[model samples]
Target: MKRKTHSVLRSRSGASITFALLLFLVCAVVGALVLTAGSAAAGRVSNLAQSDQRYYNVTSAAGLLADELSGKKVTIVRTREITTKTVTEYKVNLAGGAAVNANKIAETSSARYTTKLNERPEVPTELADYPTDTNDGAVFTDLTFLDTIAVKLLLDDANFNTDEAMNQSMKNGPEQKGVLRVLHAGSTDADPNVGVADPSSLSVDCLYVVQPDGTIILTLTNSTDKSGETYSLRIKLSPSINETESETTETLSSNRDSYTDSGFHETVTTRTTLTKTAEISWTVSGVEKVVSAADASAQPVETGTPIETDSP
Candidate 1:
């Protein structure tokens, strides 16, 4: 009986050891599964963060490019390239008065990423079609009388064409007779026949003269008109008389520091071209004239052959 009891106790001890060994094996498997799942979650988070950072960088650069090219009438192209564990490229194009287009290309061992961006300028709601004009008279007027009027006749003391006449006319007598005279009163559509007016007949303070070369000369007898009055004459002419055109090209480049964590490196290049054009236009009198800034210099008087006024 004693021997049988001892054998039973030994069997129980072996069974306990087996159970402990099974439990340890089960714990080891659970620990391994937990570790694997944690590692996978961390990797997914890292990839998501990297993707967001890359997108931000690309879009930031593109936004700056758009701002620089806005309201500019030119063509520009910008490019960027990166070669590492993954290959990446970017391109941006801007055309005169057109929208901006951006493209991104990325190649990696696992996947490829491509994106496109289109940005356009917004149309202004309040834009003026025609500039404001200050002149209150007819758009087209004749200035031929100026050529026939004698410079000495204009300076005659007997006439009220002086600065004092302008002031007295403002205060008294027939609205200051002959403050302004219309010579030919021609239109922008067609040229009118030259008509000479008698200097004796012109009582106004201002004279409009037309030159054979299609130049318009304005003479103001009163110095006050220069300081006080604003003329509202619109002349569309070319600037070729005084201005010349030019063109130029420029190149720009940059390099970005590598992102150690993301393993990204990039280099950017940009090329720009600038072109200038001359402004030219035909005058209302159907004559080619140089459009210049207002000059106060006295014009040369017509010489020889006094013109006789047509008999009424």
Candidate 2:
């Protein structure tokens, strides 16, 4: 009887030990899963933050340019297209984290750039009178005041070449992936472009001039897969001019304001300036991406290829 009781006691003890082992194994697996999920969440957050930073970096630079142009003083006697030498020594500082520092000018030898300043009809409007003109019934006045500032910048040939390759790669193989951003957009509420839509569905064209008020245009663009259009922002070539002038900057500064000076009765009021946050965006790819040019250049023909037909 004593031996039988010992055998039963030993069986019960073995069962308890096996059950405890199973429970510990289950707890360990659950703990590992929790840690893994936490790590993945952290990684995703980090990536998103980085992406946001890159977008903001470009936008900030564009805004700075807009601010400068819109603030520039034009001759009150007769407004003319002012030429700014900012591009005289074009500079772009590529940050390690994909942030572009517009203020951080890069000194490059032998690279010459000529840029146009704000081109206005009449002189820029007074700051206090900006954004609106409450009362002005038609008197058939033939005066169109300059009320917006726009700035144009072209990606350098080297950068554009690499970007052109990427664009070609994506064009040939729609499977290829790329990024697009909206650098700056003008106010559409005042004067909207014919077909350009704001809060755009982001389909159709690679470049969308959101507003045609002469303010910043080409703010957003559809991805290659979506637009199926080769990027084109060249104003002139032999002179190496690509981006538009600073007309965009001045337009945005005076986006709203239409008053007859005659109505002012020569009050001699102080010029009111409107300060706005600069928004910048353009569909450009960079060589820093390091895509094999072969993917784009290896297409079939070479030599006699016309630049007008194909660029970089």
Candidate 3:
């Protein structure tokens, strides 16, 4: 009886050991599965974070490009040779103007970013169909009058004949009245007829000149220079020139009796504010930088012409 009881106890101990071993194997398998799932989720999150960062970096780069372009001044000479960079290279040049030898007046700025990283994912395109922004009155007017005024002054002061007047007009106006007259009076044609006024000019009726679209072209003779580029800026007069002109006419007549010719013409001089767009450009190494906007639209004025206006 004692031997049988001992045999039963040993058998029960062996069964308990087997059950414990099976439970440990199950736990190990579950732990491995949990670790694998956690690793996969972490990897996915990391990949998403990297993609977002790349997108922001690329967009910021584009903004930097536009800002630099707006702030720099560049003269387009000839189209330069193509260059290769680690990321991307910009070849700058001008169209719609006379092709001159490449002159490096000055660089607007250094490269915004320099990296041997991958090419920019977003390819940039040119911004098209923008007018030259300047303060010159010629922008609002047909500009023929601006050219002709110089010619007329040269003829009157310099005594230049028809042939000389035409040539002087085509070239920029001379700096001084004496020079114009001397050049004109010495010409072979002594008796020359004055040419007709250009009909293309818009009337400067009041403080502002109205363009075809009925938008007033407020001339800004002066503009702030940034990055060595002069921007042509035009703005609309406040209070609308049409309304202000009427008010001025009323104020002028208020002190006088009806139909009485006042001693002085009542003119309203309205103050105006000007907004400017800066012109900027740069080159990729030897690749020439071109200013297409400036070249096509900028009409050159004679550097030394004395502006004249006789007071009424």
Predicted model with the maximum lDDT = 1
Residues 60-106, candidate 3: write the lDDT tens digits.
33233324333232211111111111111222234534433422222
Predicted candidate 2 versus true structure: per-residue lDDT over 97-188, tens digit per residue: 44422231222111111212234232121112212222121121232221111221211123221212112211121111122344335345
By lDDT rank, best first, the candidates go 1, 2, 3
RMSD of each: 47.0, 27.3, 35.1
- TM-score of the candidate numbered 3? 0.20
Better of 2 and 3 by TM-score: 2
* lDDT of every predicted structure (CA atoms): 0.30, 0.28, 0.26
lDDT of model 3 at position 117: 9
Clashes of each: 7, 28, 12
Q: Over the full model, what C-alpha lDDT does candidate 3 score relative to the true structure? A: 0.26
Model 1 C-alpha lDDT per residue in residues 116-179, reported as the tens digit of each score: 1112221111112111211121111221222112111111233222222112211112211122
TM-score order of candidates, top first: 2, 1, 3
